[model samples]
Target: MADVWAKISAVLPGSVDQFPLQFSDTVESSVVEILKRCRQQLYSDSTGTNQTLYPQIVVDFSWEKLNTGTWRHIDKEWRRVYSYGCLFKAAALCHNSPSAEELLQAVRTCDMGLLMGAAILDDILQVIVRILQGEVRKSTKEDADESERTEVKRIKIQCPHAPAIKEELSVPRIKCPSLESFNTNYLLPLKPVILEGIIDHWPALSQRPWSIEYLRSVAGCRTVPVEVGSRYTDEEWSQTLLTFSEFIDRHILNKEDGVKGVGYLAQHQLFDQIPELKEDIRLPDYCCLGEGEEDDITVNAWFGPLGTVSPLHQDPQQNFLAQVVGSKYVRLYSPEDTDKLYPHQSQLLHNTSQVEVENPDTERFPEFSKAPYLECVLRPGEVLFIPVQHWHYIRSLELSFSVSFWWS
Candidate 1:
């Protein structure tokens, strides 16, 4: 064992460490070869079943070198790594287990355990490596042209029109005989008009304790930058905050730099924290689900108030924005008003203007001069539906708490 360890150490970099409990190099190599043979067999006879195992093990051998951070490392180069961890256990079970069913069950259990362990280890290693790399990079960089750098800071635009009248629109007082009648008569008929108390009947609203606790837990959770298809850890979950003040103090208020991007406030995976939301929110559903794919659900928590106005962008899904607490001003344009809005060709639903509504960049977004939209205030318990492809700019009126549900 000592001789084998010495040989591996001599061949590989000092950084290339493996756990002691893991398979030895010789056994690992043998397992990998067996997996490759199984894969080739699977490829030749796709339907063939092995009696010794629950299912036939499939393997494919592909050549890829593992990196050890040094180009001069000849011994580490051209190392053959097999991709069939699952197949290795299956083949092992087929060789040693008494019954075919038992062998198959053992293989399945072993493969699953190995996969989960590998995933957890991979996450830890990635984070550690990233941190180390960042530290090294930070220590090495001092560019001569750093002082020459400049960025085009976005400007805010103010609305030329005065604030629209805030009328207390009467909530529809129709009583339905049944859920069917409510859907057909009231919900269907009022598709054009925004409904005030749609959430009043939702069972989730009544389960306020669960909802509030969940929100607080999310807010208190440690926020990392958004990454694609990454799961939040328990450590991250513990940092989720319940109150707006907590979110701002921990994340937003202390940062001396100005905020950028509407999605920047809440760390990524906020949507994943919501157990009930299986799919993203969309627009057509807001317009009575006329047709189309569902909206991409986007849930972000803003720590500070959103200062600049957002551009007019239309989405395919219906929107159900649940403002937990906090205030926002939403300006909406109708789909029929597309000609005046001057939408960009790259995206059918987005306007050409990137100008903030509070400070329109006339030089770049000249067409925005003609764009007119209706304004509404979205408070807690109220959701504003902009409809599919409707142009809108949403600005935080105060330190706000909101969750938006979109579906087509």
Candidate 2:
């Protein structure tokens, strides 16, 4: 065992490479012969399923057997080493250069017990030396909400109890509006309007969590960044990188927790992150009318649960907010209301209003009541055009996912 350990410790790293667990080395004959010998020695159970600790041992980490290898709500053993490693790898991938020492140094302290526990570890990682690196993309527990799975049509949220007249502030809704027509009326005027039929052709419209089963299969292993806060206004509000699967399991599936905050996949360039999902959407033809290059147009994703809010804020570029799944309540104030909306005193928040649009404090933010704004409950397959510098507040009314295209 000592000799084997010594031999195992001596090989090159990333010959195994990173997630989806790279194995370009396996194609080489010498590597093949070596792995063939490993198979012979580690035989009798290509699956390490035979080595069960009696009573199917559990751990304080809340690691329990859900089926075979999965446990519910356990912290993914993220350590300082992984932070360094991930930073290194992401930088390397960006620059088109990968370093082996950089990868090995990252996992230098990771214990093998975690690796040995993963059932698929031995079967795949047995070039003789198996190092278990867990980048668990989490489970998208689709079974949790049957209501989200059902197809619903034409659900729009109304802003509750406002004295504001609807006519001056009402947003227009149009069907199949062309680039020329949209440019003539809405785009040129910088007016917010909802366009239907733009997103009906998207492949993501038919995907999991929407088509939860297929999403579970393809996106289960993919890592994503998610926002976890009761609301951004809360002191405890923060962001974390998580698996698409775990995001579904905890935030989406385990929704019995009272609505204080939600797991929001907000403002992530998910189409660029999850290319498999990029096929599910297309950029609006009207975006081509922008000053930026078509490829330079920024496409962002917003996936969240009920009551998730963006507060009252503005972005620097023109926005096409496209709804893919569920509904969102959106309110917009033109840049003309900049002073009336009370821009935050801080430079970072200068573009955001101090007033909560849903429940404004007339005494504290007295001027907010006078800010003229357009309001709409954005429904599925609707795209809301938000011109740059427009102060917008967004709240997801259900488990929702949306795409926004931003261009100069």
Assess each prediction's global lDDT (C-alpha) against the native.
0.39, 0.58
lDDT (C-alpha) at residue 121 in model 1: 28
In TM-score terms, candidate 1 sits at 0.43
RMSD in Å for model 1: 17.2
Q: Could you tell me the TM-score of candidate 2?
A: 0.62
Q: Which ten residues in a row have the lowest lDDT in candidate 1?
A: 147-156
lDDT tens digits, residue span 1-408, model 1:
112213222322233133111333533565445544543432232333453232222222222122334535523212212223333333333332225343323323332322222332233322322222223233333332322122101111212233444454322233223446445754454332334555554433454422323333322222233211111111222222222223433333323354322322443344443233212222223334434333345544332344423445666655555555556767666677666555656553344334556676778777766765566666555655445555666666544556565555
| lDDT over C-alpha atoms for residue 43 of model 2 | 23
Quote each prediction's TM-score.
Answer: 0.43, 0.62
- Give one digit per residue, the lDDT tens place, for model 2 in 267-320: 555565445677778898888888889888888888776677888999999999
The residue ranges of model 1 lying beyond 4 angstroms of the native Cα positions read 1-192, 201-219, 222-250, 253-263, 266-269, 274-309, 344-352, 361-369
81, model 2: CA deviation in Å? 13
Clashes of each: 31, 9
Residue 197 error, candidate 2, Å = 1.4
Q: Which runs of model 2 end up more than 4 angstroms from their true locations? A: 1-168, 206-209, 255-260
